[model samples]
Target: MNRSEFLQRYHHLRQIDYEADYPLRKTGRAAGVLIPLIDHPDGLTVLLTERAHHLRHHPGQISFPGGGAEPQDNTLADTALREAEEEVGLLRSEVDVIGALPEYRTISGYAMTPVIGFVKPGPVLTIDRNEVADAFEVPLAFLMDRRNHFAHFIERKQQRYPVYFMPWQNRLIWGATAAILRNLSSHLCDD
Candidate 1:
């Protein structure tokens, strides 16, 4: 969808409580992730990042630019913007804060809030080698479409659990990132 159409539909979209169906262990740590949608001439695209391989947590994982909340952050949105800037050099001025999806609890121990935003096309991204290995964009239409989504089951304690996954080219998008994208797809496409 186009920028205007997305904005119009976003305001009317209903929030989906993903945690209601899939419970996760929360560590009481609040986190924020920026789901940046760029207004490309061809179509809207989502900006994502690959975490640096040396990181202690979730290293080399494909994810949104975000991290644990700090005391100086006034809101989760601020945390998202700040992390995005710190990791990918996406200046706050280049993004227009739009809306948010339902807060998600991660198995890794975080109460993550997904902050949605629209980014100006062609924003220069300076990737920080310390935090992120790469920054890239994927067409929103491909992500939102159900055809690209995949579900895999894992056996734990004799119980099977579904793991959401969306493989974009060679990069594997899974775990909380894929779950959040699934939530976004449901919100945007179901209605």
Candidate 2:
């Protein structure tokens, strides 16, 4: 989808109500932004980040640009934008937030709020080495394609957990981030 088309379609997504059914860890809240970058030759791409391995939570995982909500954040949107700027150096003004998806409950215990946004792909992102190890963009078409989505099982603790995994180029996207992407892809494909 083009920028205009994506904006038109996702703007309505903002109106959908999201339920926060899961409890968060330590009373901390986090907000993340799913920034869709549509390149000139390629159409649409989604910007993703690889977190630094030293982080306390979900270290080295493929994720959107975000983190725990701060007191200065007036709203979830603000928290997402602020974290995006801090993690990937993408300015808040450059993003056009389309909507928010359902609040997902992480196994590590976080009630994550995902804010969807469309951004022009020209920004030169300066990654924070302490938080983000690298940053890259994946074709939205590749992710939205059902053929690329797969299910995997792993035993953690004593129970087996099923995870939806998506691989883009060299990046292995799994865990909560992958689940969110799968949900978004399912919604778009169903429409």
Candidate 3:
């Protein structure tokens, strides 16, 4: 979708009192993610990052730029934007925050709030090697397509929990990241 249509459709969902299907999870701390959307020549795309392999939690996983909330952050949006800048050098001024989506509780013990925003793509990103392995964008059209969302699961301690996966280019976008994308799809796209 174009910028205007995207905003219109996205705003339509915001009018209702709604959240994603994820109920409160038992694990993890409070966190927020900046889901950056850029209107590219190809189409609208979402910025995503691959976590540094050395990290103790979710190593090498594809994710949004965010982390556990800190006292310095006045709001979840602040946390999201701060983390985005810290991780990927995404300047706060460049982001036009559209709004936030529902809160999703992660099994790793995080109450994640996704802040959606718009940005301009170029040679503007400076990836922090410590927190991020790489930064990339996947077309929103590809992600919004229901066909691209896959059903998967991991066997943890003999328990099976559903996981979502979206393979874009060579990266496997899955787990919490994919779940957030799925939520956005349900809210902003018909398919």
Candidate 4:
């Protein structure tokens, strides 16, 4: 979909009341922003970050620009905006938040809120060397395509759980990130 179409559809997504329970031993909350950048002709692209391998959680995984909520954040939206700025150097003024999807609970024990935002093309991104290792964008059309999504199973300890996995280029998008993307894809593609 194009920029205007994506934004219009996203703005109309039915708000799902969902919550995720992370497996982290400690209780905490995290907020992430799904920044969708739409470039003309090429179509819409979703910005993703590869976290530094040295990080404690989900190291090197493809994710949105976000992190644990801070005390200074007055609301979840603020938390998402702040984390995005810290990780990707995107300014708050540049993003036009459309709405929020349902909350996702990670097996690692984080109740994450995925904030959806529309960004204009061409913002110089400066990645935080310590937090984000690399920044990239994936075609929104590719992600929204149901044919690209596959059901994968993984064994953690002795229990087996089915999860969604999407592979684009050499990057593997799976786990919680893929789950949220799957949810978004379903909403956008619903006729």
Tens-place lDDT digits, model 4, residues 45-108 = 8888898999997789888888777889987778888988888898899888878877777776
Show where candidate 2 strays beyond 4 Å: 8-28, 39-41, 154-161
C-alpha TM-score for every candidate: 0.92, 0.83, 0.89, 0.86
Rank by TM-score, highest first: 1, 3, 4, 2
The prediction achieving the highest lDDT against the true structure is: 1
- Best-to-worst ranking by lDDT: 1, 3, 4, 2
- Candidate 3 lDDT over residue span 13-131, tens digit each: 34443323344445557798999998776668888999999999889999999988899999899999999999999999999998988888877768899999989767398999999
> Which candidate achieves the best TM-score against the true structure?
1
Query: What TM-score does candidate 4 reach?
Result: 0.86
Candidate 1 — which residues are off by over 4 angstroms? 13-27, 156-160
lDDT values, one for every candidate: 0.87, 0.75, 0.84, 0.78
RMSD of each: 2.0, 3.5, 2.8, 2.8
Model 4 weakest lDDT span, ten residues long = 16-25
Error of 2 at 119 (Å): 0.8
Which is superior by lDDT, 1 or 4?
A: 1
lDDT of 1 at 38: 96
lDDT of 2 by residue, 52-120 (tens): 999897788899888777789997789889998998888888888868877787766666778888787
Error of 2 at 91 (Å): 0.3
